[model samples]
Target: MTDQTDEEYREAPSDRTHVKRYHWLARYDQETVKAILDATPLAHVGCMMNGVPFVTPTFFWREGDRVYWHGSSAGRMFHALEHQDICFTVSMLDGLVIARSAYNFNCNFRSVMLLGRAELIKDEDEKAEKLRNFVNGLIPGEWERLRPVYPKEIKATAIASMSIAEASCKVRTGPPIDDDEDYTHPSWAGVIPIRYQVLPPEPDPRNLPDVSMPEDVLKFRLG
Candidate 1:
């Protein structure tokens, strides 16, 4: 993900005032937002169909709370949300955001779960715009280089929008936790920062011999 200015992101605290069970709605920090979005690839989108609740984890690209996804026009998940209410969630775990106390120990993460109704964005122009957002989010400049979506491609897929209404953000960070008695034990106790990166890209064998990886995608330092 591109480095973002602090002012570019915003997360609001949940309405719950008590920190019981999981204080999911208690924290609204920028670090929390970045950690979650940067750490994971899949997002579980919730929707209701025929009075039954359903959730499907699919490939997603997030821009703030607004998420865009496309799939076969006939798929169950896509069909279910074609004209219904839906919710989307994106989460990423960056190592263990743990601490030295039971209450303090927490996972380092940034996750945003949103609720809102969805509607198929039938406007051809709008659909094209959303598609660009998804491609850019995955690997910048891909949409321009890859073949443009054909009119048939658009007709064969379903694209929709979900308003980011009520959302909850939670996060945890720091070192490992130990009981009062265990705290005195001499043991290593700090986080080992985890990282992910993309190796050199491999070209498809069927391609006419010599296409190198794109600079935009190759420049990524996956963590």
Candidate 2:
């Protein structure tokens, strides 16, 4: 239930997860939600600290029904998030919808909003393994090529995870929808498509000149 592994659409676990405005664009299915989450490595986690709300941007990864993010252990955000209710959200814009009217102008996008409580991965070993997975998940085989992570390094970082059981996916696509009479107007109406690209690798100056890009590095692609 957490991972949205089932093919059938499910109901929102709570009213908060349901999409209200533009309700037709809201999706309550596991597959759709999971896809949106996997499409982006970045997300914002909204949490409360000392009664003040804070939204922290983080690089996140998903495994099964859970997602994880990290920050410096000494940072107030991580410590403030422990065992707290959180709103985790990811969004990627695919295109710009140019409409005949300003009101109809919008973005073609896919996004997921997740509701859950945050938990810390307290076990050092598990945390370290998950950290390794994060590096390799973004760049395959990159973790192995780097120096081993120090025990102190692990201690200095905080890993937070949240379940994805209660989540909603919202998406908008295709051309803009304008007033019925706007179709006869001279203004153009269409989508300006956008996409992500993997550029040529830029090696660091400190790297040995003889060192070449690893095969796995070349194999990396944005999901």
Give TM per candidate.
0.72, 0.92
What lDDT tens digits, residue by residue, belong to model 2 across residues 82-176? 65778899999999999999988999999999987888898999999999999999888788999999999999989999899898888888888
Off by over 4 Å in 2: 1-10
TM-score of 1: 0.72
Cα lDDT of model 1 by residue, 16-96, tens digit: 322334543344454554455556667788887778888888775555655567777787887777576566878766576
Weakest 10 consecutive residues of candidate 1 by summed lDDT: 1-10
Point out where model 1 deviates above 4 Å. Answer: 1-20, 29-35, 38-41, 50-52, 63-65, 82-85, 97-106, 185-192, 221-223
Model 1, residue 1: distance off in Å is 28
Provide the global lDDT of candidate 1 against the true structure.
0.63
In angstroms, the error of model 1 at 188 is 5.5
Pairs of residues clashing in candidate 1? 36-110, 97-108, 98-175, 99-175, 99-176, 196-222, 196-223
Best by TM-score: 2
Candidate 2: 10-residue stretch with minimal lDDT = 1-10
